[model samples]
Target: MFSEHRQRLVRQLPAGAAALLSANDIMPTNADGTMPYYPNVNVYYLTGLPEEDAMLALFPGHPDPALREILFIKRVDQLFVKWLGRRADKNTASEISGIRTVFYTDEYWAVMKRVLPLCSTIYLHTNEHARSENETQTREDRLLLACKQLYPLHRYERLYPILARQRNAKTPDEIALLRKACEITEKGFRRVLQTIRPGQTGMQVAAEMIHEYMQHNATWAYEPIVAFGADACILHLRANESVGKDGELVLIDAAARHQYYNADLTRSFPLNGRFTPRQRAYYNAVLRVHKQVAQSVKAGILIKDLWKISNNLLLEELVGLGLCTTADISKHGAQHYLNKHCYHNVSHFLGLDLHDTGYHDEPMPAGAVITNEPGIYNEEECIGVRIENDLLVTENGYEDLMKTIPKEAEEIEDLMNR
Candidate 1:
C-alpha cells in the first residue's frame, strides 16, 4: 500500500527531482520522560514504517536503480530493545516499505551525500496545512535547513502540496482502513451510550470511548470532545471536566484511528437517555441538514458549495424555530444569521488526520472522503446539537461510511436505555 503511495508521488516529481521525508522527533516532556512518539504523517504515508528518526529518500530518475528509493530507520541494539522493544530490522523495513535498500540512521548522511549531487532539485516536506502553527522544529525542519546550507546550488521545492493532492483521493486499501476506523469508533460510541448517565463527568464519557478504541487496537484520532450542555458550543473543547446534568445534551466528537487512518464522528444525545421536546427539535433540525449535505456529496462538488447548502438549510430551520426572521436574513445575510446559531462549517476532509488533506477550493473527486457535520448551538436554551458522519464520494453520489452507526434520535434513546 505504501509502495503504491510512493509510486504515485514519484510520478509527480520532475525528472531531475528527489524528495526527502523525515519521521517525527521524540518530543521531550517533564524531566527525562518523552511524549508518545507519532511518526510524521507524510513519512508514514510514503514508507509505512513508524519509528522515530526514520527517513525516506526518493530519486525516481536516478542512474542507479538500487539507489532510487532508500529508507533509513533507527538502529536497534540489545540494550535499546530491552527498554523500547525491537525496531524494524532491514528485511522487515524492506518488506513494509517495498524499498529494498534500508540503512541505519548513522548511514543516512553518507547515503545523502551520494544521492544529492545527482539530483538538481530537492523536494522537502514541511507542515503546509492552513491551520498548522507548529512552533517546535521537527526533524524534517532541521533536515531542510541543513540541506539548504550544505548544497547552496540545489533548488528546493515544496513536497507537501504534491503529496496532499495524491492523498486527497482514497485508494481501495485506504478506504478499507478508514472503514475499520469507523467500525472501531462505533464500538466506542455504543459503549459510551450505554455507560453515560446524568452524574457522569465528561472525562468519564471520554474514558469509555478511549477504552473501546484501545480494545480494538485503535487510538484516538484527535482529542475527544465530551461536551455536556453549553460546552458543546465550544467547537474545540478538550477539557472534559464538566458533569452531565439531566435534560442536557452531551455532544461527543470522537473517533478511532486504525493503522493511522482516521474516522471522525460526532453524536449528541440526551444525558438522561431521552431528549426533551426542545432538544429533539434542535437535534432533528441539525440532522436534517446533515443528511442533506451527505446526500449532496458527489464528484465535482466544491466544498464551498456544501457550506452554502448547509448555511441555507440552517437559516431556514432557524427561521422556523423563531430564532431568526426574514428581516434578519435580508440585513445580515443567511450565513450571518445562521452563524448566530451555528458558527462552524458543515464539512471537512477526513482521513489520516481529522482535518486531512485536500484543497477546499478544488472540486471533490471520486474516492474523496469527507465529514458531513451540521450543528446548531443555542446558548440561551443551553442546547448544542451536532450530527457528523463520514461520507465517501462516489461516481453517482456518496456512500455514508458511518451509516451503520446509530444516529437517529429514537435509536440513541433505545440504545442508552437498553
Candidate 2:
C-alpha cells in the first residue's frame, strides 16, 4: 500500500512537474518540552518516514533519471541523538524507506533549485482538504507561501484533493493491514468484556486496552472513548472517570492501529453486566440499523444515501420506542432540536485517519473499508447505545472485519459476567 501510494502520487505529475511533500513539525506542548511526535500521513503513506522535519520531493518523468524521488532527512549528530534520541541517518532512511536518493536537510534548496527549472508547474502540497478546517498552520503551509514568493511565475496547485481521491480505495495490502488492526481491536474489546464490572472506572478499561495494545505491538488509533450513562450522550466524550453508576450503559468506542492502518469499533455494554430494558431496546434498534447498513454496503452505494437509510431506520425505531412519531419527523427536519439526542451520523471512512479522507458524494466502490456504527443517546433517560463494526467492501458482498467482537447483548453479558 505504501509503495503503491508513492507511485500513484508520482503519477499525478505530468512529464515535467515537480511534487513536494513535507513532514509534520514537532508540536510544542508548553515551556521547553514538546508533545509527542505525530508523523504526517502523506509522508508516512509515501515513504514510511516517521521522523520529524523530513522532506520528500518527486520530480516525475524528468529528463535526467537521477532526480525522480529525492528524500531529505535530519542530520544525526551524536549530542543531538543522545538528547533528542536517535534520528534517521541518510543511509538508514534510504534502507528503511526503499528510496535510494537521500540527502541532508541543508541540501533541500540546492537540490530544488537544480530541478526547479526543469519543471514548469510545481505541485505544492497544502492541507487544503475539507478535513483541514481544524489545522491552524503546517510546515507545508509556510513552505508553499515562501516558494510562491521566491518564484512568482511558477504555477502552483493544491495536492490535498488529488491525494484524497487516490487514497479513497485501498489496495490489497492496505486491506490486510486494516484487517490486522481490527483483530487487535477485537483482542482489546474482549479483554474489557472479561474485566468490566459495576464498580470499574472508565480509565481502567482504557488502561486495559492500552496494555493489550502494547502487548500485541499495536496502539490506539485515537484516544479510546469509554463513556457511561449521560457521559455517552456527549459524543466525543473523554472524561475517563468512575462516576458512572451501576446499571448505566458503558459506551466504548475504540480501535487499534497496525502499520498506519486504522480500525474503528464502538460497543455499549451495561455496568452491572446485563442490559436494562431501556438500554436493550435502544441497543437492538441501533444494531438492526448497523446490520442493514452493512448488508447494503456493496459496490455503487452512495454514503449520503446510506446515512439516509440509517436515519430513516432510526426514525422508525424512535417511533417504536415512543420517543418520537412520524408526525414529529414530518414537522421537524433531521436537525430537529428535539432529536439532538440522536448521536452523529451512522459511520465514516476508516483508515489512516480516524475519520479517514475519501469522497462521499460518489458511490463507495469495492476495495474500500468503512465503519457501520448506529448510535442513539438520550440524556433524559441517562442511556446511550451504539454498535459498530468495521466493513470491507467486496465484489460479492461486504465482510465485517470486527466480526468476532461481541455485539449481541447475551454474548456481551456472558463475557462480562464470566
Candidate 3:
C-alpha cells in the first residue's frame, strides 16, 4: 500500500529530482523543559519510521535500490534508552519502514555527500508551503540553508509541492487506519451521549471522551474541543470548563488517532439530551451543508471548488433560518460571516496529522482521505453546531468513513435521550 504512495511521489518529481525529508524539531520549553515528542508526519508517511531526529533521502534516478533510498536516525544507546524510553535500532527501523538502506545520524553527512555528487537536481523540503498559521523555524529549514552553503553549485528545488500533491490522496492501508480512528471517535461520542447531563461542565464531558479514547488504545487526533452554550462560538476553544445549561447545546469537536492515522469528527448535542426547536433548525442546516459538500468529493476534484459550493449551501440554509433574507444570501450574508462562524473550511487532508500536512491548491486524487466538516455558530442564540466526517475518494464518488456514527437528528436524539 505504501509502495503506491512512493510510486505517486516518484511520478510527480522531475526525472532526476532527488528529495530530502526531515523530521521536525522537538520544541523546547523553559530550561530543561521540553514538549512531548511528536514525529513529523511527512517523514513517517514515506519511511514509516516514527522516531524523532530522523531523515529520509530518495534518489529515484539511482540505478540500484540500495542507493535509491537512504534513511538516517539517531544511534541507539543504553543510557539514552533509559532516559527517553526505547528507541528503534537500525534493524528494527529498517524492518518496520521497508527501507533497505538505513544509517545512523553520525553517518548521514557521508551518505549525503555521496548522493549529492551523483544527483543533479536535489529536492529539499522546508516548511515553506502555505498554511493557516506558523511561527517556528523547522529543522528542515536549518538543513536546507546548510545544504546550499555546502553545495553551492547543486540545483536545489522545493519538494513541498511535490509531496503535498502526492499526499492529498489516500491509500488502501491508510484508509483502513482512518476507519479505525473514526470507529474509536464514534465510540467516544456515544459514550458522551450516555454520560452527559444538564448540570455537568464541558470539561467533564471531555474527560469522558478521553477515557473512551484511551479505552480503545487511541490518543486524541487533536486537542478535544468541548464547548457548551456561548462558549461554542469560539471555533478553536480547548478548555471545556463552562457549565452546560439545560436548554442550550454542547458542541464536541473531537477525534481519535490509532497508530498514526487520524480521524477528524465533530458532534453537537443538547445538554438536556434533546435538541431545542431553534437548535435543531441551525444544527440541521449545518448537517445539510456537510451532506451536500461530501457528495461532491471525488477523484480529480478540487477542494476550492467544493468550498464554494459549500458556502452556497450555508447561505441557502441561513436564508431558510431567517438569519438573513434571500437577498442577503444572494449578496453576502452567510458567506461573509462564514469565517467568524464556521471559522474553518469544510475540508482538509486527514492522515498522520490531524490537520495533515499537504498543499491545498492541488487536486485531490482517488486514494486521499479528507474531512468534510461544515458548521454554524450563533453567539447570540448560544448555539454552535458542526458535523464532520472523514471521506475517501474512489473511482465512484467517495467513502464516508464516519458513516456508521449516528448523525441524523432523530438518531442522535434517540441515542442521547434513551
Best by lDDT: 1
Cα RMSD (angstroms) for every candidate in the order listed: 1.3, 1.6, 2.1
lDDT at residue 218 of model 3 (Cα atoms): 95
Candidate 1 weakest ten by summed lDDT: 331-340
Estimate candidate 3's alpha-carbon lDDT, on a 0 to 1 scale: 0.81
Q: What TM-score would every model get versus the actual structure?
A: 0.97, 0.96, 0.93
Q: Per-residue lDDT of 1-418 in model 3, one digit per residue for the tens?
A: 5556666777777876788888888899999998988987788888787788889888888877697878888886889888988878888888777778889887887888778777788888766546646776778888888888888888988887777666666667877888899899999999988998988877788899889999989999888898888888888899466787788888888889998888888888788877878888998899889988988988777877788888878877876887777776557756565665666678877787676655566667788888888888889888888888888888678989889988999898898878
Note the residue pairs that clash in candidate 1.
Answer: none
lDDT of 1 at 249: 91
lDDT for each residue of candidate 2 in 1-418, tens digit (9 for 90 to 100): 4567888887777767788888888889788989889888888888888888789888877776767888889877889978889988878888877788898877888888878777888887776555557456778888897788877898887787777767777888888899899999899989888877777777887888878987999999888888988888877876377566788888998889988888898899898888888889888888888888787788778877778888888877888877877887788865673357565778788788878777779877787788898888888898888888989888777889888888898888888877
Full-model lDDT for every candidate: 0.90, 0.82, 0.81
Off by over 4 Å in 3: 1-4, 63-65, 328-334, 337-343, 357-362
Deviation in Å, model 1, residue 107 alpha carbon: 1.4
lDDT sort, best first: 1, 2, 3
